[model samples]
Target: MTIYGYRIPMMASLIVWCILWEIVGRLDLLLLFPPFSDVLVALGDVVNSRSFASAVSITLYSYAWGLGLAIVFGVALGFLMGTVPVADRLLNMWVNVFLSAPLSALVPVIMILFGMGAPTVIVTVFMFAVWIIALDTRAGVLHVPASLLEMARSFGASRWTTTWKIVLWAAMPEILAGIRLGVIRGVKGVVIGQLLVSIIGVGALFTTYSNNFLMEHFWALTLILFAFALTVGQLIALLEARIDYYAGARS
Candidate 1:
């Protein structure tokens, strides 16, 4: 970030927000926002509680299953669409529709099919994340150089070998980008799924806190979710940086 021709670290912006939040909280400017310090204290309490531990375990379980399925199916679908024009023509419109649609509205349909349980939440995450991943992967695969494909063919590489070695490697930067985005969307899916389909895990905690007007605890929990999403994003971004040479090679 920059101001007045001087660059500022990104963290500085977050610090400024915190300072503002603290000031507003101290002044009791909003009933929803308690003092930042109090929320920080509540954060510790929330983390150490047994309920938090259980919630974390359940949430992680659902998240993992959902994201795993999304990756597998999404990558496969993307590969198909990218490699086969027929598949692309058949699926492209629906994929774009789902990607642009209000996915939250589909949660109730999922719940009806899967019932009010963890399965619904898992399916919700998968639905929320898979389309974007497939779209990005298709884009990446489509961008793989024709020269690379020809080289693989000249080397007498089998179809699977060519795709696995040349195409996938070249397309990896965008693939990872898609996965990173999918991860963030999956978090939202998990939260919404749990809240609506089954109030267990962190959703339950959110309910407990909000229903009782535990604003500090509510904000603390919100911060934790934000931190988790940001931390995952940063980790994937680092991985993207490491593999960025692939993009440069493509160009």
Candidate 2:
């Protein structure tokens, strides 16, 4: 809906929010809460600054590397587990354990083992995001139609050929969903890494601003996180839509 050349729904809500914040902030509801205008200016400055760029870049670097590793390992492990009962039984328990363990709680131990660096952060992200993907892939394998496998076998397709060409194709849709989720997890890991593991990126700046009670800077870092996460999410959604289109055409 549009009203006065602005989205009525979103614009109206924003107007109401700004008015409420201005009123409350001017009324001195809290010492910690800075005025909205201060936050917007700080956010604008942070976005254009070098510190923000470095923090964002480092975090994305770790996230990308970690996510890549997870996709490789997770898909391989999931394929094996889905195909071989023994492999499934052997690793399922440990995967469950890792999945249940909170990443925040494990950060200290990871730091102790890995010391302080990007490696620890990357490792943390991979460990947390891999299992969901692995499980999804396994489900895809399990759900592959027996008829297709049989048809391939009857046509003299070797076991390897049938497994790769037929079984793997059937599982891809589910696996894609898992990949989207894994990327989100990776983004979170990157943010956490910035905060906890040596704090070289936005997280460190967030801490500095926080210590000095610069609420604007703290909020600014949070805004960066939102933007980064949203960008990744949008990319994933676009990819998913394309995949769906291709799959639909084939079907």
Q: Clashes in model 2: which pairs?
A: none
- Write the residue-wise lDDT of candidate 1 on 26-46 in tens digits: 999899999899999999999
Q: Which portions of model 2 miss their true places by more than 4 Å?
A: 1-37, 245-251
The deviation in Å at residue 134 for candidate 1 is: 0.5
TM-score on alpha carbons, each prediction: 0.97, 0.83
The total of clashing pairs for model 2 equals 0
lDDT of 2 by residue, 1-251 (tens): 88789677755887788788767767879867667777778888888888778877777777888899999998888899889999999998887787677877788788889878888888878877898889878877887777777889889999899878877777887778778778777777766766787676766788888899888777767767776677777787787776674345335
- In order, what lDDT does every prediction score? 0.93, 0.78
TM-score winner: 1
